[model samples]
Target chain A: MDQTSSSFVGFAGLASKNKEATKMKAKRRKKISGADLAFRICNGIFMVLFVIITLYPVLNTLAVSLNDGTDALRGGIYLFPRVFTWKNYETVLSKDNLITGAFITVARTVIGTLLALVMNAILAFIVSRKNFIFAKPVSLFWVITMYVNGGLIPTFLLFKSLGLTNSFAVYVIPGMVSAFNMLVIRTYMRGIPDSLEESAQLDGAGYTTIFLKIISPLCKPVYATVALFVAVGQWNSWFDAMLYNRMASQYTTLQYELMKLLSSVSNQSSSAEAMKNAGEGSVTPTSVRAAATIITMLPIICIYPFLQRYFVTGLTLGGVKE
Target chain B: MKTKAINMVDLKRQKVLIFWAAAITIYGIIFNYLPLAGWLMAFQNYKPVTGLLHSQFVGLAKFKLLFSDVSFLRVIRNTLAMGVINLAVTFFMAILFAILLNEMASKGGKKVVQTISYLPHFLSWIIVTGILHDALSGTGIINTLLLHFGAVTQPINFFAHEKYFWPIVAFANVWKETGWNAIIYLAAITSIDPSLYEAAAIDGAGRWAKIKHVTLPGIKPTIMILLLMNVGNVLNAGFEIQYLLGNGLVQNVSQTIDIYVLKWGISQGDYSIGTAAGIFKSVVAIVLIVICNHLAKKHGEERLF
Candidate 1:
């Protein structure tokens, strides 16, 4: 008798669920309010405008980069190349400083991201250990670094004193550990179950062994996120090169080379000289700057879509604790 | 004796952890904490030749000079104006874009729009500024449109003018950040309970009414927390864009606190004055953050700390 009565209730629940689903379907079909319709139309139009506005500048830059240098100076190019030429790119890619800069930028990005990830992850792992005695103090020690800093001059002075100036190590060493990234990694590590470590320890695995063989492997997503952040930062950073490595042409990064080009173009007088020197008159400063801009951003654009999924998750994970 | 034995065992167990911690701690001391000693330069008439040790102490004279300087005052004004404008414009646009995106019916289309929107955030400032320069050039699309529409007989040199600097900076910020900032709000919106929306629908509330009552309140905490965090960073109006886009024509308007520091501290080799300006900026930041966090706690909102 109990079973029969439960079955009857379950049937009633299912019927109500079906009724609700149908109601939702009907509601979705019956959207006829003029105000609502107007909002939808307006919203649609706004989204299209937003997309165009966001894209048009980049697209226009690409167009300028592809167009004939002299023709582009007349400045009617908008979306597509009016007079197509590869000379701009050929000119930009052929420059000695730019080539050196690209090599340095790529090397720094790769090396910096790897080193930073490992250091931050290890620090995070140590703090995240539930039984670690100095966890709270160590965490606080790093977190304080986020708020207070030595400021620009002192940092510069310190680097200069340390002989980090005019060296490749200047880029990789000073930024090896970010407090924010460490915290994000710590937050992720904490969510990991302690049982995994406990079980590993029971099998006579040491802390280092557990960290390497167990914890780090499980942290692929957050690592991807942090790596992307660091790589992008390393790639985009030019101020350090401008500041510390200004005299070290060998250590110059791509962004700095682009910056030099951009300033020259903006200055107008030097731009005419720059144009004439570039590609023997086929590449104007405008075209060359656009091409350089495109080249500098191309790697980021190519990798962005692929890494988009990781960043969204990473951001949310970091956001949760912070 | 028993307690000592237990302590030994605990220490033995923690030996590896302590080793790693000590390594990182040393690094932190050198890279992070050691920089604080440089703050003393603010109190000195520092010269690189004499160094920090032998530099003569000047007891707030540099701060006094900073406060009294006309250019410094102008720099402060520019910083505050640009900071406030950027904060308000970017904050509003992000929220508005998020809400509109949330209201869209087609999930696939929304995703595509969002993907496109975030394309600019990945591009470096060098690239963004380059694009801005081209678009704002006299012969660029903006002037071309303006001239074609008979808005002006002559092309307006956007970068040459002082009046357009702040708006252009703010617009550049909005263009670069709006889509990226919207991600957090969009997350907050998605996490809102669907039952609440259903209940509103059942109560015969229209779309706008449902959004007003349900969606806005749901994301209020996120909005407040982010706002507080941003307010603390008010002084960092951005050095790169201003420094990049700025020229001799708009130096008075374009110069910010960071640029002022760079000029006095780095360029002019007045390390003391630069450090003083840096300290001022840092102090304001800390104070603002503390106040905002306190306010958030008092108002029963999420506190960053």
Candidate 2:
């Protein structure tokens, strides 16, 4: 098993070396032929077009969301707003439900991520320890869940029986330990020199102390990556909110509220009622929905660039390093 | 006697580790294994009032009903068709994107394009679908552009067209995931030997030949492993996009097995049928995985397990 696992690590090592070599070779290239020039031009053109395709939708939404809703309906607003207004954003921000939903989203992200990280880290430490008696079985117990699950309804039923439905605990408890992430963290922890832990153990440190003092600090990269995954997952998760807190309006997350709002607004706009309600504010369903998209997406977009550096490392290590 | 004392201390130390393991064990049992136990609801004629204990054991009846139901059959067809479209388009595009991106000369340009492209992956499905909805609406930019280009006589409500839903979903998926997925393939491409490309160039091969002979072959293993793993996810036709974008008009095309389960099992209170449908999906998933793993082993490729 160790041999097989090490072989997988060999794949990543070779891949990273090749990446470095490719980058170096790109820098050392001497000349460009006509065909190569053409390919480069075409590739550049394709990438520009790809960028536009990926970016235009986002920019269009921003433009529309910033524009006056009534003006936006006249159409042809592609990249920039003709008549800029803050009313759409104002309406979205002013909504009591949305404000509360934002609070819920933030709270869930922080608390749920912390809980999951601590528990999973503790579990990962134990399973990665070579001397632990139940290490193999514990690892197998969690890993098996990755392939087989009792389906959504059974899980829902279990949550219901546990009185976890329609409560905030539903968000944090059911996701307390992720087998996949535990394995990733465990893999990372195993790479830490055994001498580090042994030295700590000689100082009268227990597993818990070594885990907190010796292991956790050294495993920062994996922790940050796992935390990002957990945070984003909790923040963006609306299905759980839809299922578990359908009746508990107070517990609604931002994404779930936005989802509900979008559907309801669309449903109403098609009817005569929404048109009648249009005079109450400058916010149309279209603009509000656009604004909601930006509002929901802004935090992720803001944080993603700084965190983007971690993604390749995290994905490579977590995915291929085993 | 001294060795025995040392052994006793080691056991005591191991006990401290066991204490931590015990907590996780209980959590695994409750969250993971307990759900497996809940699979019994599929076999029972389940009702909330009777609960699992008292529910009548009507084995396979719910599954029988599922196959007999026309809508459920349509749902299955829709799921498989969309899954295939999604798998094909995303798989091809990611590889193509990786190869194209790899061929680029400038590091700064590649980095900028990659960062911009991966933005959509982090956004929630709701946001992605919202962007899609705005882009594909009747008066949306796509129809507007199509009209300007004389492709269509009038605006097309993309979501309303049942036949277009699968392709629309596929395009949305490609738009969202292609860049992120390309990262792995790009890594695989990078791992390919530069000397192979040099050898191809020495043989008087042009850029295309070099790509065909070296780059593609280099990334073949990565593609195969990814493709095999994706085959196991054929039933995950997606829930968020379908649930969000779908209306009554496109129900036939948009309703996946998950939607069916949610509708029948929870909303409609036919727990047994819902659980049966869920079981069917899981069984298909497990079987696909096993088959793919076997095939990968035979071919000497990486098996996920």
Candidate 3:
């Protein structure tokens, strides 16, 4: 098996070496050729298009958010702010839940990712052991889940029975171990030659010690991959928050916060007669919408470039495997 | 006496197996695989107040009521149509990308294209739909491009129109997922003995011939297994995007089994009805997977089971 893996390993190693050597070898030479120029232009176009696609709403909403509320509704805003004003941001910031909701979202994502990694890693490592006689059945048990489900109603009822409906534990516990993620980690772990572990055992390390010092250290790439998946999952999790966390006052994840704020305003606009009867100020909801969107996305947008290297590493590793 | 002692040692070695059974069985019972019993609710006039025992058992009544309901059928139709369209488009795009990307000469360029493309897979549908709502609006970029090319004088109402909803949803889904999906096929393609490609090339084969004969054949099993696996998710027409992006104008076309469950089960307190719908969906999904797996086995391809 190692021999089979060696050829690809050698090829990748050589390619990396060539890349470094080329930088030294052609220190004075320009990197561009005719084809390279065309490719660079193509890549530049693609990169611009990709970024715009990614931040289309961010740019639009920024414009709308910066525009005066009346101007926003009059459809004067386009790619840029028209009659720029920060009143929308001011209003949304001063509102009841935005700041607190942001904190709640951050806490959930951080804490949930940590808990998920610990539990998922332990379970995955135990299952990944070649000597574990029950690994096959255990793996099959988890795999069976990818095919069928208990359905939403029963799962909700189960959560209710477990008293997870109103608590913070509900956010993380039910989803701590995703079978697909476990399988990914396990497969990657399997690729680690058993002999490396056998040699470690010869050095007198027990299962737990070997797992902690040897396996865990060696599984850094897989750990990073798992961490990324878990973090992303936790960051965007609102369906659970919406489903179980009623009393909209309790815990509002950012996604849930945006949905609540946006949907409520939309719903309110439909019942404008009711709003008029209530004598609330006529706030241009579109301004608030843009401001709220910006608030919800700003953290992710800020974090994307920082996490992007890890994202690429994790993705390439996963992609190279089945 | 030594044989008996050796047998005892083997029994101790199997201790972890027992632990695995104990742990996973509990997990299977608690979180997954166990919600299956919720199918009972589908037959009962379930009331949370009454609990499970006291609910009136009415066989096929929920199914009958669901069948009779016009909205349910419409939701099913929309679900199937969108599901099929998405599968078709995503599969096509994924295959095209896998082939095109493999043909690229610059390894650095291939990596860059892939990395940029896979970024959307990390985004929540809330964000993706937010982007779409802006991009598909009356004066959005899509409309701007259309008008720039003299395609239309007026901006098209994309999100509101039912006719446009499926295509928009398909396009967004394909954009988000095709890159990620293509990677598996690409990996399979890469693993094909390069000697085969060499052999094909030596026989006066062009790029297309090598791709057709060598690359496609190399990944066919992966394709089949993935096909079998994906058929199981035919009813999952992506709830978040459809739910969040959909307005009253397109609600009739946007509601799926998952969305229906959310509405009737969670929102309206019709838990039994929702469970029935969910159970029905799961059953169909499982059946399709089994059928596909069986077909794959018959054709001498890899089968999941």
The numbered model that scores best in lDDT is: 1
What is candidate 2's lDDT per residue for A189-272, written digit by digit as tens? 888999998899889898878888889999988898889989999989999999989999999989998888678665764524
What ranking emerges by lDDT with the best candidate at the front?
A: 1, 2, 3
Model 2 superposed RMSD (Cα): 6.1
- Model 2 lDDT, full chain set: 0.85
Error in Å for residue A137 of model 3: 2.5
Better of 1 and 3 by DockQ: 1
**Alpha-carbon runs more than 4 Å astray in model 2:** A1-31, A268-273, B1-7, B203-205
Least accurate 10 contiguous residues by lDDT in model 1 chain A: A1-10
Q: What is the interface root-mean-square deviation of candidate 2?
A: 7.1
lDDT of 2 at B68: 98
Q: Judged by DockQ cut-offs, is candidate 1 incorrect, acceptable, medium or high?
A: medium
Among all windows of ten consecutive residues in candidate 1 chain B, which has the lowest summed lDDT?
B1-10
lDDT of all predictions: 0.87, 0.85, 0.73
Candidate 3 lDDT, B1-305, residue by residue in tens = 22423355445644554564576568667888657777789999999888887889999999999889898888888888888888889888788778777765545445555655665676677766766766776556788788889999988978668888888899889878876777777777878999999899789786668888999989888788777767778886558878887888989888888898889998899988898889878888888888987898899988776
lDDT minimum window of 10 residues, candidate 3 chain A: A1-10
Q: Give the TM-score of candidate 1.
A: 0.93
B12-110 per-residue lDDT for model 2 (tens digits): 988878887897798888988998887888899887898888989988887898999999999888888889899999999999999999887765566
Per-residue lDDT of A1-322 in model 3, one digit per residue for the tens?
1232233346566556656765675575755357545754565565446545644556787788787765555553667987777777888787767776777778888888887777667777778876666667777777777777888899999888988887778887788777777776777778888888789767876666767888889888778777877877888877888888866556767777777755654455333442443232434665676787777667665554344445434444443222
Best prediction by DockQ: 1
Off by over 4 Å in 3: A1-70, A74-93, A264-284, A298-322, B1-25, B104-110, B145-154, B189-201
